[model samples]
Target: MMRCGSVIKVKPGMLDEYVKLHSSVWPDVLKMIKECNIKNYSIYYKDGYLFSYFEYVGIDYEGDMKRMADDPTTQKWWDVTKPCHIPLETRKKGEWWAEMEEVFHLD
Candidate 1:
């Protein structure tokens, strides 16, 4: 299994809306995530930033990710989430939420 983290800036004053939207994420979207071998998924918010962490337990990480993105339900889910996030200006090539580096870990 592999763990990944991503960070994004939440639009200035839309934190409430973002939280509300997530509190009731679509059923199909959740189903697709599990189907793609994503587990222990969670999102955290602080100040104006949002952090997401998840584990990839599949044989092919890229393939499972592609499968998730190709799903209609997941696509629709992104449509709603995209507007709520403000991508960093320094985002790297082909990156959506800039990948975060793990500075400290103990386990």
Candidate 2:
């Protein structure tokens, strides 16, 4: 399995709305995420930043991500959620959330 982490800035005054939206994520979107082999997904907020962590059990990460992106339900979900996030200025091109590097891990 592969572990992933990412970071994004929550728009000013939008943290509550963003948290509310995620409190009840769409069922189909959740299903798609599971189908893509993502597990133990979690999001955390601190100060103005949102951090995400998940494990990918699939053999093909890129392909699975593409599949998730192609899902209609996931796309619709993103339509609502994406606007709440502020993309990092240093994020690589084509990236919405800035991918984080894991410097150390235990267990």
Candidate 3:
């Protein structure tokens, strides 16, 4: 499995709402994530920033990501949550969340 992490800022005044929304994530969106071979998906927030971590078990990264991205449930989910995010300006072009480099891992 490959581990990935990403960070995005919660728009001011939207942080609490974002957290609440995540507390009851959509079932279809969760199903899509699992169907795409993603596991251990988790999101955390602190100091107005949100961080996400997940494991990719799919061998075909490109295809799996494309499939997930194209899922209608996911698209609809993003439509609601996207406005609550503030992508770091320094993120690479076309990236919403700035991916974090893994410096260490155990197990």
Candidate 4:
């Protein structure tokens, strides 16, 4: 499995709504995440940033990500949560969250 991590800034005054929305994520979105071979997904908040980590078991990582992006449920979920995010200026094109480089790992 390949581990992935990303970070994004949460819009001021929107953390509570963001957290509340994630507290009970939509079932369809969760199912789509698993269908795309993403596991152990978690999102954490710190300061003004949100960090996410997940393991991808699929061989075709890009394809799986595209699949996830194409899902209607996932799109709907994004619609609700995207407003709460303030994507970093440094993030690459088409990235809502800036992908992080893993410098160390044990296990």
Highest lDDT: which candidate? Answer: 4
Q: Report the lDDT of model 2 for residue 28.
A: 94
Candidate 3 residues lying further than 4 Å off, grouped into runs, are none
Cα lDDT tens digits, model 1, 1-107, are 88889999999878989999999999999999998999999999988999999988989988988898889888889999888899988889877798888788776
Model 1, global lDDT: 0.90
User: Global CA lDDT of candidate 3, please?
Assistant: 0.92
Q: Per-residue alpha-carbon lDDT of model 3 for 66-98, expressed as tens digits?
A: 998899889999999999999999898867889
Global lDDT for candidate 2? 0.95
Measured with C-alpha atoms, the lDDT of residue 32 in candidate 2 is 96
RMSD of 3: 0.9
Judge candidate 3 at residue 9 and give its lDDT. Answer: 95
RMSD of each: 1.1, 0.6, 0.9, 0.6
TM-score of each: 0.93, 0.98, 0.95, 0.98
Residue-by-residue lDDT tens digits, candidate 4, 1-107: 99999999999999999989999999999899999999999999999999999999999999999998998889999999999999999999999999999999999
Clashes of each: 0, 0, 0, 0
| Candidate 2: Cα lDDT at 46 | 97
Model 2 regions more than 4 Å off: none
Looking at model 3, the pairs that clash are none
After best superposition, candidate 3 residue 22: deviation in angstroms? Answer: 0.9
